[model samples]
Target chain A: MAKTIEEINEKIKAGKAVVVTAEEIIDLVKQKGTKKAAQEVDVVTTGTFSPMCSSGAYFNIGHTKPRIKLGGGRAYLNDVPAYTGFAATDILIGANALPDDDPRNRVHPGEFNYGGGHVIEELVSGKDIRLVATAYGTDCYPRKKLETWINIRDLNQAVLFNLRNAYQNYNVAVNLSDRTIYTYMGVLKPDLGNINYSSAGQLSPLLNDPYYKTIGIGTKIFLGGGIGFVAWQGTQHAPNVLRSDNGVPRRGAGTLAVIGDLKQMKPRWLIGTSMLGYGCTITVGIGVPIPILSEEILKYTAVSDEDIFAPVVDYSGAYPQMKSDILGEVSYAQLKSGMITIQGKEVPTASLSSYPRAVEIANLLKEWILSGKFQLTKPVAPLPGVESGITFKPLKERPIED
Target chain B: MVVSKRIVLHFPRRVVERPIVYRLVKDYDLEFNILKAFFTPEEEGLMVLELSGEQTDYDKGINYLTKAGVRIQSLSQDVIRNEERCTHCGACVTICPTGAFELDPLTRRINFYNEKCVACVLCIKACPPRAMEVHF
Candidate 1:
């Protein structure tokens, strides 16, 4: 018997909803079968905590006494440059933005101590941030320069609008070259010394709903330790990709563009990270609950680490050149075991994503649903799925022609 | 009574030219391994040494250095792992040369054994959250 989201909400309102985490659902379906488990479980919560580089926030700083027109001027938050091409007092800051004095990669493995991501985290933590803006004197707004300290509570609006996040699946990065290399995936030692991967595996949101059956635009989720929603299909979202026997994607595929009120978020869930030689990025914690509307949806939620596989890519040659060659494929189970055999040699593995934190977020979301503090919402529309016939395109470099 | 200790010796400028380490082996009958040493002609000299001998002899050797105006500090507490900042992401588990980091099988949490750490400082950069810090 299939259930509707409306019915699930009614059960949640009455405090009778049967909520389980993605980790728990794996065993539940195995013991009780999909048919019986689907009838019993109302929602399965999923979570991931990893570095999401394509994230940022927009803030509407209140107009100053003289009202500086910052739209055509320049603005900076904590010495980090912000995009001020919008209306006066409105500015956007990306997670990867660095200060003018940041040494960056000039020192080989640069230490990005602070950046836009740190500003966002400090803002969410209610710390006062220094805002500096310069503009040309105008009639309506004659202030040439203005500097002030602003807090999230004082801002007219602060919204976390990420372009891409919550990657469905990603590659396991390794190095085949004789020299050590530093990348966004972490440091890869020479001669396949170590492997680094970024994914929550079975507890990931999109992996639990491979085909986007229950996840889509306007889907409510736990973002940065606060309530948020899926705004759209994230940038570089490629649903049409190679898949395993099950519906899970074999490589990096689906992604989500999420939005939420930055004022309600916590600093712990949104951390500022410095990737050795790769500059800076923000580590975001996101949790999406999959409503079990049918047995198939329930089965998808039961996907385990052993069933999910990620391709091992050599970052030295293939990734830098945008080549499609891969070394081999390894399962999450093998990765979690702390070792995997690659090219006839046993290699150690590490994860950039925090699995323990992912589990905590999933359990917190489940508690919210069970206590009736949170309710599920049906997506207003579906995302482009496998049948969309969308192929991820590479950049075609062309010279300027008159 | 035999014991081994890794200690950092700071030689004051006045005693920089003295053979303080030679006395540990010749007079105190202790085995010494110098891990790192930096010295200038007229400046303070610094040396990280691992010394092993009888507990009484080790204590005497340290006393002899202290009397010579050389400051001694333990090397065990140099590298520190801040518990609040660590997310247990396991990035340090693989990069650490001495296997100082261990991931618990059940909890998936990283256990940092500072005793096994050689203060190589590799985990300092490998850690994304900057949880690992070296005081020296």
Candidate 2:
């Protein structure tokens, strides 16, 4: 029997008729339990949606103004803190890169010699918003000592406190475990001109030569592992940069563990969970210059890993979505296709391009659509440039080997 | 189930004193008493105490600390919102488990009455425009 809108909504809202069937639900409940039903829904929906949309992008479950988007990659596994220190450090850098040059860039008062970090500000043409990051300081320790310092309980408290201070200042936070960072370790010995993106017409001593200039906007320079770009050397500094990665510029041995930490650590105080394993670092780097010519110059390094499951702030840009189920059961049938709609009406989903959780949510939405269950309304007038932001390729599904 | 005999009220890192008639009330095995406590807000991470005692004991407790020139007042809600940054996105309106915020249907914004606020800051996380200011 064809179900009416009232009937379907009633069945769905009342939990009378199960969508997938009793046996499937029973099998899923047995395999993953009640807690994992939503996750299993994710896996199924993601598979169904890949053909419909792009990776790292989504038109949010219920609305469209701020398109639900995804960023970073999965890093922590099994509570075993991977990139524990590295994750915190990325937040430090990511927070520092805010458009506003706030003095609270450094986490610790005395940690960095300089008060303000180096800034990288780029206005990518046709891009949604300005991309920027600043570094307050750069200090290198034997990685072992760095790890040990992070493990100490008191030291950990102090670091979190200081990181919180930094986050508060920048109005940003980090999701430590679910942050996906692409790390390049032991990739360069600092001996080769291969990395020298300088636009010197003639090749001389690559290291000692201050004449080294990066390629202008037109020329293409190769970044190993299929990542190549017309790399332009930004403002240079005389400081000694680390250079000990394997020859494979992209496939360095070290792990770039993506964490779930928010770039801003303000959320930590409310969460009752004891922060056991978290680490951070903030390094000063010259702003990578974007060519006035092209947006394609924005290259994705092999270290580029996308985080598909982190919550993002609303269009207002204050905080991520709160965990309360404030919006009751708005049926999947009411979702519209082209216009990002919420509650059967089109509204901004907030540009979620930089959000880490948009992909997962979008995938869920697509599955709900494909099942022939939703009443989708396509926008009468298509939103300009909205379609281009969706990344088509998704990360290959991680197979669960029996 | 563990019965909680006492609870420590830190009182915003401040010290205060009061000598008033009080009674220890048992609400579901948890004992709560209104008594004079000491707090010094000037010092960071200071402790505030609430004593469970009789009228004479309360007087004695107040007398013990009154000489120290402690101020006394009812606990006030911590003001977390920064007036300058608050765009009032109605996030706090949706997040407050208590009906602390009432939206102006005309403006589509929130009116925060702190008396009703439980200080949960769920709205702080929900305010994506970066509006919620936390004094804490």
Candidate 3:
């Protein structure tokens, strides 16, 4: 027997049924409306914490590895920091320290992308990895050197999408006609001090779609217009294929690749292999760890105080339901009194005027969904602005609330 | 010991048209302290400066710039301020790519810490009033 609407509703409520198509989503949205549509179905939330950082590990990796504490070394001498303490061959790994004591486990910012289960496997496997991808809303001017860098330290395969290469060759694009024609030149590897590949000479790696277009002397490259480029790369390549310039087996193959300004491609990463004849492929060599040199010590300094401070905030069980899919489509005007929460505290009881920010954030959540940039499984709370004024003020004098 | 330091500056030509004719002077009156600022003739929009302060002062300024919105870039030592529009609200006081700006102790005016700015546009974008500009 076919399932009745009530049975379907119960199944969805119990998280047994999944909406597979846009039509189903529309039907569900129409049936329940906005608020309840969320509750009827599974709504994932994510919370973010300010990152915790260290000065950096100083080390030298030859046949034998030697390590040194970064804090105890001479900062600079004769206008140059001495590199005598360690070799430049050390691999500097940026790490995020999770709060071990807190029962409510939350990932620190920049350490991992968001979306999906909070479990380590889910995060490492790249499920629901959170990201904030933005495109120029209105046709605006592009810059000649608006560079974006994605440092690939590990060969971990993940889904990468929403790629765009914008150009500001001219000062500004006042109108669609005035838009500078962007002629996407070739990609470059400054480390190699040479061009890697050219858009003209290389086969168009761009996924053929109307949204992807060239404008203003081909100065700006917008994929899918606001539409973006998506690709996946992860095939078992030969382990020792990649090596250092000296030809020694420094590290594994396909571990690091830097994407300069390519108006034709969006900056994204996705796990899995590509369908035949789609997306450009690039190989990265994880080469021997670059030793930490004395002169380069300052480069690793955590200039911002944030690099030293750990966040004091925490996130827990839902105190506010930003929206209730079960409530059906309620207009913003109908957004009830108690639909959102923060830090495990209920919204209504807290009676904080900042609750509206949650609503503003709800709109951001909807936009995140439409962008298809990431599917989150944790509470991705926006990092509230923290003030670290120039003049040092004690905690009591600081303008912030824990 | 005091010495005149040689500096090479790359600045925008439109605002700083005459590099040689116009001396690079900071409102704070910083001179004979192992620091000198000058606009370069080769690059109209570029300025070069040399500063000799107790090393810690440089570090503090660089830290301030990184926090206030200055972008620390690789490849070159540069400070690029776009003059097309400068609201001068003082966000750059903290957002300098290298912590190059300071509030004058008495006048409360913005002072340039030439050796500290790294040319990051964090302040330029953060400026709600849209007064400052960053080139690189």
Candidate 4:
């Protein structure tokens, strides 16, 4: 049997919809079978909470007193540079942007305690932010210098517009070098002292909808603890990749570009993160509700940690050189068990993503649907899938003349 | 009763040259394991070590250190995890040498055991949220 999103929305409106988290749907399918579970369940909510380097926010801070033209000017939010190339009073702050005085890697294993991400988190938390700008004088907007304190509530508009997020899968990073190395994957101890992986696995949004069956452009979702929408197929969207028999990508594949109103988001879900020796980013919480339109879709949603696998890649050499070399592949079940055996050596594993927070976000999204406060939307268009023959490519460095 | 306690000793510049930790073993009959020590000539010094001895001897050893003008504090007081900032990502669990962090099997939340922490400060950098802080 098959169901339509409209039918599911009708049930949600009538308070008759049956909703469960992606984790719960696994056991449900095991007990009731895919066919029965699909018929019985209306929605399966998936979640992931992890540091995404591609995230950032843009804001319109409203016109300044006497009008300062900031479109082509320099702007700093809490001493971190922001892109002011848009309109006057509008600025974009990337999560990875660092302050001018940040020593960065000059001091080995630098402490990037604060950056643009921290500024965003502070703004969302309703704290005052110091805005400093220097503009070239203009005829219509003649003000040259401006410095003020702004809050999210007083901003004309604040929106989180991430270019790429919700990675389908990622590599498990380990160091095989002689000494410890720091990376975006956190610190990797020497000789595989510890393994670090970041992904929600079965509970991940894109993993459940691996083929982009339902999740696509304009699909409403829970972003940073607020209602948001998938804007487009994310940057570096590589759908053509190795997959297990269950259709889940075996490596980092599809991604989503999400957008949401920053005013509605909570600071808890949008947290500032500083990776020692690496840089700063934000940990964003996102949840996507999958409507069980068919038994096949339900079966995909039932994918568990045991069936999901991630490649273990050495960060010291292969990762830095962009070589596709993997030490081994391990299941999320094994990774989550705290230990994984690679090269016949028992290695302890850790997760950069918060599973407990992912569960909470999924449950919260389920509650929103059950209370009729949220509704599932049919995607306006589908993301390029395996059939599209789209493959992610690396940059080709060439001579300027060529 | 025998007890093992990790403590930090602060040496003022006047007593910087004194061999204070050696007296804990010779005079008080306590076993000391120095975890970290830093001192410059004619300057203040600091040492973190775990001392194990009989309760009476341990008290006497601490008393002797106080008489020597060396400030004493618990080693656990040096490093701390900010509970409000911690998201329980388990990044500190595997990196901790003493297994001071554990993820609850049922709740999947991180449970920190400060008593087991040796204050190695490995978790201070590993934590993504910068939750682990070192006061020293």
Candidate 5:
């Protein structure tokens, strides 16, 4: 029995939709099989809340008093650098942008605090931030310097227009070096002591919709606390990465660069952060709904942690080179168990990605979709596909070990 | 009783010559695990240690260090989270070894149970909001 989007929409309209989270849909498909589950289920919600480094927000702060025509000025938002290159009162903040005077090198991870990501979090939380800008005085709107505290409420337009985020799957990091290493994947101890991987696992948006069928441009999504849309193909949107038998990518593949209104966002869904010696990053709670239009789609949504595999990379070295020595393939189940044996030593594993929060986001999105409170947009365009060519080879040519 | 606690041991250059940790183990009959220890170029030292022993012995061990002029501060005083700064995103809930941070389930918010925390300092870095803080 095959399902169709039209029938699913009807079910949703009549308040008779059978919606299940990606995790629950897996069990449903396993018990009832894909055909039956596909016919019975209307929608499956998928979510991932992780520190996406490729995230940023654009703010049109509107005009300042005396209207500064600051063609080029130095702008600081709560001591963090803001991209004030453009005219008007517009500023862009990258998620990884660190404050000019960040004390990251001086202290350890927890103490070296605020950065651009933190500024975003504070804005989302409705907290005020010191906004300062200085420019060479222009005759049109001669105001050389202006300083004021601003909040999200006062901004004309505050929207999250990230270039890339929500990776299909990512590398698991471990350090083989002798000293402690600080990375975006948290602090890795010397000699492969601890392993850290970041992804929401089964609940991740890309994992649930592997081929980018239901998650393309214009798709309405849960961005932070509010509804958002996939504006365009994400940067480095690679779809040709090598895959396992189930179509799940073995490495980083398929990404979504999402956009959403800042006014509608809730503080709890977006947070800013600074890592010791690693700069800044923001954790975003994103949820996308995959309509169960057919048995094929249902099966895709049913992919679980045990079925998904990723390569462990040594971030202690540079990339492309890290691709040369693949540190064995392991499933999300193995990674989540908190331990993996590498080089005959028991290495503890930790996920920078939050599975608990991912599940919560999925469940919340499920309720939102089922209640007909959210609009599900059809894709305006498909993401990049296999035609683009795989960036690197993975898995297939594994040198048969002894 | 084999109870355990986390403490920071500071060794000023003047006290660096003293046998502070050795006496705690041998004389006070306490077990210690050094989470991390660092010596500055000036010879000042700061060590994060987990000390365990009978309740009376642990107290005596800590007292002995205070009298030796070795500053000791509890882990609870060092590892803290600013509730206002936290988004309750639960990023720390998954990385926490001792279940100190957990999901409320009903509210679906991450809650902090500081009592169960081991202060391994893992959550401090894992936290995306930078909400879980460590005070020196």
Candidate 6:
């Protein structure tokens, strides 16, 4: 009863397609097994809405009335800096960029209140943001400065060109220090008082499509509110991470460089967030529809919170550190239950990733599939899935200047 | 006639040294849970407390506190979740100290259980849409 992509599309065309969410697919497979579930479910919709630091939006600001050349350093949008290095009018805004008057250090250690992420959120929410730029009056461009307000509608081309997203999997964080640590992972209560994780678990796109055969270049997805595509293999895509018998990555693996038209996105699907001490990040809402190609694909979609696990690491030191405190493996279900025993102490668990939003995105994609409004893309290029040893190295470890 | 209510209890300096909270349970036969407590250097005490018991015992507990100069205020106060603004992302579900927020497994919707909310305000800032608001 293995279904092909064409067969699924035919079912969708006939308006008789059976679609299930990543959560529902879990039960369907557990009861009927992969073969039966593959026959029953044609598509499994997955989603995740979490803060991704490697995200940015580009805009073709078009020609200012006097053709002002943006000379890089002095340009801002709604009090947030825009990378003017792109072109005279075209500018890029990184989600993590902070405003000049943010008053970060002026306050307590962690409280980075707002910046580019907030501006992006406001823009998506359909609010106007001030756009200011200055360039020493160039003889060729002939403009010194410009200051105006622009909304998404005014821009000729506004696109969300995120470089990295849909992280295959992530770590669970626990702070063992005496003081509360504010991190992009959320506020960590000290003394292993709490644990915070940031994955939608079963609903996450990369989790459902453990192997990128079904989710690769040109794969259609729900980016923000509008349909988008996986532009490329995301930066730091380690297709080579170790996997469980289930074929799901056991560590950080592949990611996505997603892109979508800004005009088609909704404010609810995107947000700007400020971590009190951890700076800023844009919470991106992404949903990818996984068409059940066969029994194998069905099994991947069946991953549940109780099934997928992450290691708990200590954030008291520099992050992304390979060494972990080895708090042991725990499932998303236990984490969501609100507490887990770390070092024999009952520590509360929290998640920076929003499950409700992820579910909403999944359901939204489901509706699109049922209504035949969205079509699933067969990957043109397969993403790497095996263990790749291509470790990025910094140019020569810093040695004494001999 | 058992009931539960959340209230803010302020103890003056003179009463700070007294074990009034312990006395409420021993003398009045009432149950109390302290959600938060702040003991000032000046010996003043502030607490967000929930008390439960039979109507008679609860009344006696209130009487004992008032007679001892403990000022009390009810916490009808709550955090407001703007229905229009909430996208039901379930971000608050995991962070709530009191398990006030949870996702409905069947519908995949975030449910706010007010009865369990201690108003720690963790979700207020966590809410991306600025949907969760606190009103004390």
Best by DockQ: 1
Ranking by TM-score: 4, 1, 6, 5, 2, 3
Model 1 alpha-carbon miss at residue A330, Å: 0.5
What are the DockQ scores of the candidates, in order? 0.83, 0.02, 0.02, 0.81, 0.24, 0.27
Model 6 Cα shift for residue A177 (angstroms): 1.7
Docking quality of model 5: it rates as acceptable
Q: By DockQ, is 1 or 5 better?
A: 1
Candidate 4 chain B has its poorest 10 consecutive residues by lDDT at B113-122
Every model's TM-score: 0.97, 0.25, 0.19, 0.98, 0.82, 0.83
Q: Compare the candidates by lDDT and give the number of the best one.
A: 4
lDDT of each: 0.93, 0.23, 0.23, 0.94, 0.80, 0.81
Ranked candidates (lDDT, high to low): 4, 1, 6, 5, 3, 2
Tens-place lDDT per residue, model 6, A215-258, is 88989999988999999989888877657788877667789999
Once fitted onto the true fold, the runs of candidate 2 whose alpha carbons sit more than 4 angstroms away are A1-391, A397-402, B1-74, B120-136
Kindly list the per-residue Cα lDDT of model 5 for residues B1-136, writing each as its tens digit.
6799888888888888777889999999999988778776569888888899999999899889888888887776778998766655554654676778766645546778766765677888667567777887
Candidate 4: RMSD over Cα atoms? 1.3
Better of 4 and 6 by TM-score: 4
Docking verdict class for candidate 3: incorrect
Scored against the native two-chain complex, candidate 4 gets a DockQ of: 0.81
Model 3 Cα lDDT, one tens digit per residue, A1-402: 222334433544454543321112334555665455543443211111101111111222222112223222322211112133332222221121122232222431111211111111122332332211122222232211111221222222222121121100001000112221111111111211111111100001110000111111111111211122222111211123322232211111111111111222222111111101111111100000001112121112101111111111111111022221121111111112212232342321111011222222223333443344323221112111112111212235557788
Please give, for residues B70-134, the per-residue lDDT of candidate 1 as tens digits: 99888878889988788888888889988999999799999988877767778998899889998
Q: List candidate 3 stretches off by more than 4 Å.
A: A1-402, B1-19, B22-136
Question: Residue A398 in candidate 2 has what lDDT?
Answer: 92
Which residue pairs in model 5 clash with each other? A117-A272
Off by over 4 Å in 1: B13-17, B36-46
What are the TM values for chain B, all candidates?
0.88, 0.46, 0.34, 0.94, 0.82, 0.72
Interface RMSD of 3: 20.7
